[model samples]
Target: MATFFGEVLSVFSRAVEDDEEELEESEEDEDILRELEEKRQVRVHWGPALELIPNTDHRLHCPHLLLTVGHNASRFVSVFFLSRGDWDAVGHVSLWNERTLQSEGSACVLYRHRDSHMLMCQVDCFVAEDQLFQWTEQVLSSLEPSQVTVLSDCPAAEYQSAQPLGTAPRLRSIHTSACSEPTCCPPVELPNLVSGLPAAVMSFCQLQNISAVVYQCYSDVRSADSTAMDTFRPAVEQLAHSLNLDLCPDQDVLRKVISQAAVQSNLYI
Candidate 1:
């Protein structure tokens, strides 16, 4: 190329210009990823009920917190506790990830008893591994619960036993050092480890010196059903007296819950 002054100049090739554009695009993509990560962080939203607490500090003083993770456990809580209509929807936690399918309203909901200091959290959505710790922390930070109980479900195949499996769903438990109540189920065996949100909550409780117990039900059936839900009945009954929860909900409500779950699981629907 020649300039107007008659001086010769070398122009860069199209390939060099294209490489520069690609570099700029790569930088833009990195920015987008960073922004998306920030957006995906786990967040807890408190409802008006919690905000209207009489306490000066406005902190939720939960005497007991019952957390249910996964479809089966959530269904159990739905049928046995929430169906009573004595609890108020006090808050919810929201997070964005590839595995999460439920909307924010239904994913992770917090319900507080109308008259008692007990709170129940039902998590029906999938929480990714990286977000587990953040989810646990954000959910627990608002509440000062004396004791925490976690109910979760997993595939029965994941459980390893030397003998043949039984008819009923197997229950495995893990608890923090501060826990005082005796676990209704046996301790989870080695090599069959607890993971995901339940494990994260347990770890957080342990580190915080909060009394916590996790009851993990291993169901043979792949889908949620009354049978799997029943496995937690004993544990629920044990805690019901102390928590002032209903030991047995109406059979009609139980049927309704199971039917709704069945309809959702149907492929033809």
Candidate 2:
């Protein structure tokens, strides 16, 4: 996401906590339509991506955002609200020509060590080595893409570093004699996900292929029986218009379907 988009996420995340109050304020204006229109902005984007770290014991039931971002030739960003753990994010950047021999020969591998927030991603898909390094620099420059480390090592060698993003919350591990006892397992707390994007967020990711790639990853990793990942297209697209209009229950809808997720393919989009 761009600097403006990140600010928008902060705005919408804060708005989710203030929905009741915002709803109440909207009611006082009498013109419900106009109140909604004031919610539109192009600076923010809200969407979903798979957990880089998967759950081993229980199925998570959070509402993963389900909108698609279309394809484009320019750079754009998608910020995911991680469901495996609250607020831990995994971001994607649409940054390749996607139409070259080198890119065609390229591949990537992703690894997530047990019981850690650390994710090590090694990329192999790129038409040019300079462009690959450039994109890595751009991605690392932002805080939203936190905990990322780029390496120029060959395909055989892997680097290890304890590089943690400054703003991300630390994942606390449980260590005690009770670890081997099944009866003492702690309860799992699922995050209550907010599905629809406020107009601002929709425009931010829709700028390029941001939303499309986001929906692509989540759809690919989503469990077969998980219908909660489904979303209505008209509702998602109207987000920009939703800032001014009411959503109809009968809007024609479409589901985001992606056959590839990085979790399965281990490749950056």
Candidate 3:
């Protein structure tokens, strides 16, 4: 009986091994039909670094910015807000597309509290070769898509020729870290005033001055229900009023921006 049981266990083990082998073979076969990796290069100059920008650690509150850029599947670059208002230093992550920027990708930027008067900015979900198509959307979601500015390596001539634009986004004129820790401040929660709200909202709220805050919210999915907008309208209106920002609850515009964010962030069905 012992010998018979041993034989049965051996057979079962063999069967499991065979199944795993078959699955591996099937996956390998599928890869054979996939597109080959292409080698390309793209130059992304972040304009020029501003040397006179104010340090971030000393201020009570200041604005921050983040950017995501890439051209190919394996090549990508991202910027962290060392200081917003003027000069910036960015860390580049380029393990895949080391040369060109054509692949699809995404990036997001958020301000995390480091300490009492200091803030740390981070970029995440950056992929190079296999997962480049969604980098832009990911970064945008991180940066709050609705608040993003898609900048390209445009020539000075093209920029001058471009249509009218509002004032440029604020950057830190000079930034300094106080013992590598940001000063802590009160938590500020901005209301979700957009229509067709998404399942989850990711907020990047920055405290500027005691009363004003800069926040960007990314939702997991787009809302199809019309009433969803109503639920968030009052919350958003109250938030703006509380913060003293003179923004009216523009349902139509808010809906369009969120919808565009959903698409650009690749929050698709």
Work out the TM-score per prediction. 0.90, 0.20, 0.22
Give all candidates' CA lDDT scores: 0.84, 0.26, 0.27
Candidate 1 weakest ten by summed lDDT = 50-59
TM-score, cand. 1: 0.90
Which tens-of-lDDT digit does each residue in 14-104 have in candidate 3?
Answer: 8888999999999987776442342222111111331212222222232222232211100111111222222233322222344333332
Candidate 3: count the clashes. 61
TM-score for candidate 3, residues paired by index: 0.22
> Which runs in model 3 stand beyond 4 Å of their true positions?
1-65, 68-95, 98-133, 141-146, 149-152, 157-269
How big is the RMSD of model 1? Answer: 3.2
Write down the RMSD of candidate 3 (Cα, Å).
Answer: 17.4
Residue pair clashes in candidate 1: none
The better candidate by TM-score, 1 or 3, is: 1
Output the TM-score of candidate 2. 0.20
lDDT of 2 by residue, 1-269 (tens): 24754653333467676898788787877676565434221111112444322223322222122222221100001111111222233343333343432322122222222233233332333424334334333322221221111111111011112543132111111112212322221221122111222122223333422321112111212221112222222223322142232323211111121232324444554
Ranking by TM-score: 1, 3, 2
